[model samples]
Target: MRAEWVLSSLSQALLCVDGEGTINYLNAAAEQLLNCDHHTVLGLPLESALPLRSDKGEALKPALLNELASAGGEVKLRTSGIDGREAVMSLKVEVVRGDGGEPAGFVLLLASHATASSAAAEVINHLDPLTSLMGRREFERRIDNLVNDAATSSRSHALLYIDIDQFKLINDTSGHGAGDNLIKAVGECLSAELFAGDLLYRLGGDEFGVLLCNVDSFEAKATATRLVRAVKRMDFVWSNISHRVSISVGVVLIDQYTLERQAVMSQADVAMYTAKENGRGRVHLYDVHDKNLSRLHDEMDWVHRINQALSKNEFCLVNEGIVPLGDNARADACRHSELLVRMCYKGELLSPGQFMPAAERFGLMPQIDRWVVQAVFDYLIANPQLRAGEVMFSVNISGQSLCQESFLEFVYRNLRRGNVDPSLICFEITETVAITNFSVVTRFMERVHELGGLFALDDFGTGMSSFGYLQELAVDFVKIDGLFVHDIDKNPIHEAMVRSINDISHVLGKKTIAEFVESQVVHDKLAAMGVDFSQGYLHGRPVALIHGAGQ
Candidate 1:
């Protein structure tokens, strides 16, 4: 009667299994949870009613009772219920000894921990508080288990690392509250689109990760494309302002070929960044076609050579002319070649594109920038005629080096030490990196402006733009992006955008520069459209105005 009453009072479904895993008793809650009566459950094998299996499917050993007696603790057993619902049951098997202290049938209390919360909800709720999606801790734990299981079971899995495009722009303009709302909306969309077996994880701030088990590349890529399309269709409207959002995804298939979890993740990241470089708002798959890998290899090789060149002072400056506005409204007011820097590698001259990206990756850009300035100053000291009157030289400033305040101070110090006029040197910053850290960029521009230095916004109209931010940058020169200027005579839209930018810049007291002007037809069209200055094959190819020693 005591046992019967004890069975009647349990809140969780309780089950007592014999040493052979045959059901001996069923509590009232257990009957309700499994939708079966005591008569039906009792004397039946546990696995007949539940899909519960151990690391090995052999009936849970009688050793459980011995171990529980020694440990005095509970163990968790997970299985599916009679209705095929996933369930978690805690098992505590206590030793029941006979009068002689020999082991008899043990008492087992199996508590169902699987009420109300579905497996999906349970998984989602355990994520990080901020993102309301799988936290990094949970992600690592799950991946670790997957890897461990794969080692023995020979299963396969894949992970997709997704990054949102122009996320910072939203955070900056609309405030972080809007940003948080957008992130949640994206998470909800992902959750709805994924199937039951797949898991979508929010990997912190505008980045999400997915874990797919037993999925091949073809299916994985198809799913990824669907996700990308789903996201592409999503429009976020905040305070009556609507904006379209998109993502770049990098999918990595995990199998015997994948060395480790970190390596898999790194490959996905590389692929994601590759997508970014290709273009935003598109999906780029990881393949052997990406020349970046070979380029990266060459870049590493170039890094050593660049370092050696820098140490040996094997860099030189060759000025490219920036023509001033003239009286004819079409000719230059005496064009002068601004000192541009170059480095020699293995007896061959390497331009900025060949080595700048690698230099920035390896933390050598600032040193390279300073070396260029010093090299130009040395050239100016040697050529007094070039320095006479209002001479100006244009120097390319890297986005990475510009972010470092110390680098700016170094440039200022060098200019003063070289006795070169700050007004005579123009600093060129590409449009993409200028808007990266908007507030920091504005402050930097103001500092340089105070010293009578000039600023040129290079590659304008190339990056995704918010005209509001553009107006705020207030640069002195607007260098039209090559895409807009390239074949402008053929593309009316390109011509229109260039003309619009030119009009906007001129009205704001900023001069316009058209780069990549290839033909006389392009030059004539730009001049007719009132372009202030043009630079390209039509004007001149980038050539050395001054050469020596290594020449």
Candidate 2:
């Protein structure tokens, strides 16, 4: 027991392999020393955990293990993780004997400074521990240096983003061990194709980045095509089960025109997705002029910006008034407005029209919606003036958020935690979203109504058969779609649709708000038609939520 405790306590990694060469025990330090967990390797053959190889990249021979009984062998340790880079380790093996003086098993002790070895630490920092690839950090740094290098030299380079096709299938069907083996094999296959001065790195899960040095567009495309075919030709066998694997390649040329490291990476990623979209196991060379790739590139750019906006507290709230149309507009309506979100990005306040489509496309709307909700809740807690039930703040939610099962809990928790006036908040979702996710939306709205909160269906008249949807949804307000409202005066069909929606909503005990009420003509027209409220330029423009509209 004491010996076991001592073995467990040792800072250096240790492993015990039975005479049959199966690992029976491993210390905690061994996990970190090799960047591995015991659940995958314990009770398995030592080679399953450590596929040791030599300087020539040949598998360590079985004869070497038998020789370790007398004079121990030294070999570099390898345990592939995400990156699969390895470091040199000093291995000393001692044979354990049974009472009959026969070999029971072997105790392999690690003797070296894991942290104290400067050479190992340097390799660990830059090279991936599982395979020979450099790693993502080094890949980025090298790109930056290479971009700067392009200014002085006339040599061209290219960035290729390689992604394993259907990698998740391997993990799901066979196991993660097979997935790891596939990664190692793919790395080897790719490395075999590298030219002198070319670099490769494991960019991330099932993805690799290759920096092809001294290659023009023609040469770059040729090389990328070769990479795609090479992976297709690889006959990867894991655990005696052969699995077919292929990779999609996206290539972006690097020249004097190359701007920054991130943009280059983004382009490569976009191109890779393009290849995958077309069909897996192909190559797509990025062309800035291609409309589809260009649009995807822009969205990728927004994805980065949106991530930054969330982390940096760059999102701010604004409100546009929703004033009643009749003579008693002020007394009946109070200070009602719909909350709008703006991003203070890169020294410019960008409206939702600028960034929202991208956010929705990339499934970032749920995160943005949460940020708005928490911000509004926290803001009300901080300021007493915004707490009154008279001032209702309507917030827009996206369909992606409605699909999330925990989103309702998140909203409920914040509302309960802050003790903010429930009636002062109104949640809004597009008519399309509310219709598609009808069941979840109904449950969410019913809960809000139960809490004395309100629900609004925004952009109401755009859908083909929305009147029927209105009959089922217990929404407190319906904001006529801006597409209809913006040209309501000029388009009689739009005006009639607006009037019909307004009358139906009133019959259902719900108020109606006309969006895009740009001119007095439209406002007066809405008033004459008995629209309950107006929200747009004519009534009021949006102002920062911290300061209320000047009544």
Candidate 3:
């Protein structure tokens, strides 16, 4: 009964066949799979008890199992049940030899196709193909189990987040093959140093995560430091060039306080970044009250929220009128409406100021910017009246997006695909973005110009080389920075800064727009200085960008 219970619980079906090809025993799983009870088929010939055909539609007899009793191997066959159900299974035959070293009987193990495929998929999902290290999915699984264990017991676990220092330099100089080789080498080096029970994972890119079980805080720190020192002494050789490698580690102790995997991972990530920030190739122990951790936790929350917003279509747009100021009533300003994005999170509408920093830090700006472009283009498609000629729309592009060749190609495809006039759309890039991605930004501006689209240099007068970059950007509008405009009415220094920016922009044939025009006094001063347009709360607040009048 005990042996029967064990065989009954086996996921794979099992059977026993004598050398004479007669079935003598069958487990519960085998009975169900063959669509018969063991009592009904135990004494029957194996071929007659459960008739099966191979994948090629050829019937295989019971004598095939007798032959496999000596040369053990497997065969693929499909069994058709009495209930009109069919199952494809791989059957392995093991030789049950007698004490005389002669074949006596055979033991059969059968795995259904569905079960085999699922097992293969589990391996693919949990492990990274590049380094053969467990990936984030596996990390979360083990950590969640450990967290649950910690809740009921005093068991302690430590999480160490490791990032390869200056890894981008290797990729940039040696190409991706070299980078991949280095990653694999690093994984092996780290794995060699881990204890038998320790867990290591590749958390994507040049980052790895380690889980140290049943360790105290002091031991966890020492382990993290050892790993860092181990990595420091390693040399990775690629294509005849020998390069030194190092990793910065962040160690977080998971005691009774860890609520979930995300909390510990985020804390470890925060500590890892701090270690990198305080100069790479070291370990930083996570403190509950660490200021960096607190800031990073908030940013991590925002990152999750931002991703949710993008996927759920909770992101929306509003418009603030970029009204023409005085005689400088430029048609470009009159034709354009500033399109600003907001997040409809829960019941509240969040401005870009609330979430933009997080979006920038985690490299989500490219995705967000792509979402905005597609959304704006979709809106224009739905509303023909809003297309380029009558009312031009200006959308802000991120510095991160500006640097990608794919993003530039995406913009070009949209411009050529749409019915909307390219001349009616304006792409606003910040002065800092233009300067930082100088060549890429220049190439983008040239392409947009060729397609008849307009460019606006936003947040002007902020950079030290603001005027110097302005001479080369060829933007239709130079938006004066709000820092200088916010206090233009009170401070002469700010007034002079705005004045000089406006004058330089005009000399280069670029229209100037003053931002943060909060009062009539500020408005009049900007108009007197010949600023072409103004956008501020005093002129008009942001209104829902509906199909009709609200915009």
Candidate 4:
């Protein structure tokens, strides 16, 4: 297509300018927009042809024209119409790249009031009067567009939910005028920090939204932190009373995982709430793995279902056998199995991976732990032969349950009631759990050991203080983390890590159990490394201890 044909086809006014800001060409729409003859304005500078000013009536600076020529973005300004009346115009500036991809000149596209006055008015109506920033409605509109763009182009954006801390106190103590001034000052300060493509919006009274274009989690977090620090340093003087303000920011990354605009806002809101809950004047990034935020709407639903299941005894117990790897007769004589809990909801079996995270996050793990203990005891009482034999069941306990004062008492009570042998039970605690509630877990392990029950450190290699905790806590076995055991036969680093963990555990006189042992090669490797036990799909999947009861 011819350049002139394309320029004339555009309905918006188009002007071609040289590097010196001298106008060289004006399309038909541009001549009609300026209401001037094309020959008369061809050689004139942009400032001479069109008198431009800011919304506040300040003359447009020469520096801004230079910035516009190189900015490659759109900016809004007011210019005089043919009748000397003020007209709002949106100017999109683009660099005209030469054959060598160097900046040759510039093309300025002007969408004027004559062409889009109604649309411009609609946008202006959505601007906050005090801050002159886009309001919540426009924010929502932009978010929707960003969401659609992300879906189509695989682009990423970030949404920051910023809330001024103690803003209500400021408004209540000082007058409304002072509060308005503070808000305007904050808006200006934040706007100054924004880049060309970034957007700032006044979501509501004390809340604002920042739309960061094409940023990842790290960039978004850094920007949010900067915003928080900026707000913290802002000093507002009202009625001769000096006041300092801070902000709590919640950041959500917008990408393919984002379901919709509301989802994005909801995630950001949840993150903001987390920041407030943790402490004011901080930034929190939304974690997709966080159960509380992931199922925010269905939290109460899960709570109710879990409560119902606990009351009605709808939870089931399963077990997977752990086989001894070496030729240790003692290890082979004592049959070991890991106890897993599952839920039966509406006749469907649910794995612990689905509900245990929520159970732990909401402080319901103690109750669930008690239920699992009672269920295991009942199973032992029913199958007296297994309990009387050399079989020992390893029950997994959550960190929350371990810290509770009543959990240990509850376990003792169950043991006494069922008259079950403590020697047949072994409790498993993760390495992280042992390190987090160190004192309580140590006491719990001592109490269990005193009662002839053993303890195993689960996911041993995942925590930073794994070896240190193994030395501190008196665990009889260390279950190597599955991440180090999943493909040990194929990955040298994983094999070396597993070997190091095994050697360390042996040095501490604790047996090592390597989980995720999927292949014969892995099993043989673990045996050769002197690992005590191996557990994974190669052994057996978890099955109901009481056949047909859980299913």
Displacement of the residue 488 alpha carbon in candidate 1, Å: 1.0
| Per-residue accuracy of model 1 over 307-384 as CA lDDT, tens digit each | 898899988766565553333344544444445667877787778787777788766888888887777666666665
| 140-246: candidate 3 lDDT, tens digit per residue | 87787667656645678789999998887898689899889889988998999898767899999999999887788898889888888888889788888999899
lDDT of 4 by residue, 238-322 (tens): 9899998888899999887787998888778778867876789999999988886665535535766899999998998888989
Q: Which ranges of candidate 1 are over 4 A from the true structure? A: 1-296, 324-334, 387-389, 545-551
Worst 10 residues of 4 by lDDT: 1-10
- Give lDDT tens digits, candidate 2, residues 1-551: 23654454345678888888888888766765666677789888776557554445544333455575576555444434457666566566778889999878888766443543564676578877677688988788778766754644575678889999989788757888888888889999999987865788997789999887666888888988998888889888877888888899999988888888977888898999889878899999999999999888888789889999999989999878888887648458477888889999878899999999889876798899999999888777666665454688889888988887667789987776647888888999999999899999999888778878888998998776798989899999999988888788899998888889999999988889889888999988888999888888987579887634332
The regions of model 2 sitting more than 4 angstroms off are 1-117, 127-133, 144-157, 163-200, 205-207, 213-248, 255-263, 273-282, 288-303, 327-333, 345-347, 385-388, 406-408, 547-551
TM-scores for the candidates: 0.46, 0.65, 0.73, 0.49
Better of 1 and 2 by TM-score: 2
In candidate 2 the C-alpha lDDT for residue 344 amounts to 95
Best by TM-score: 3
Error of 1 at 377 (Å): 2.2
Candidate 4: how many backbone clashes?
0
**RMSD score of candidate 2 (Å):** 15.3
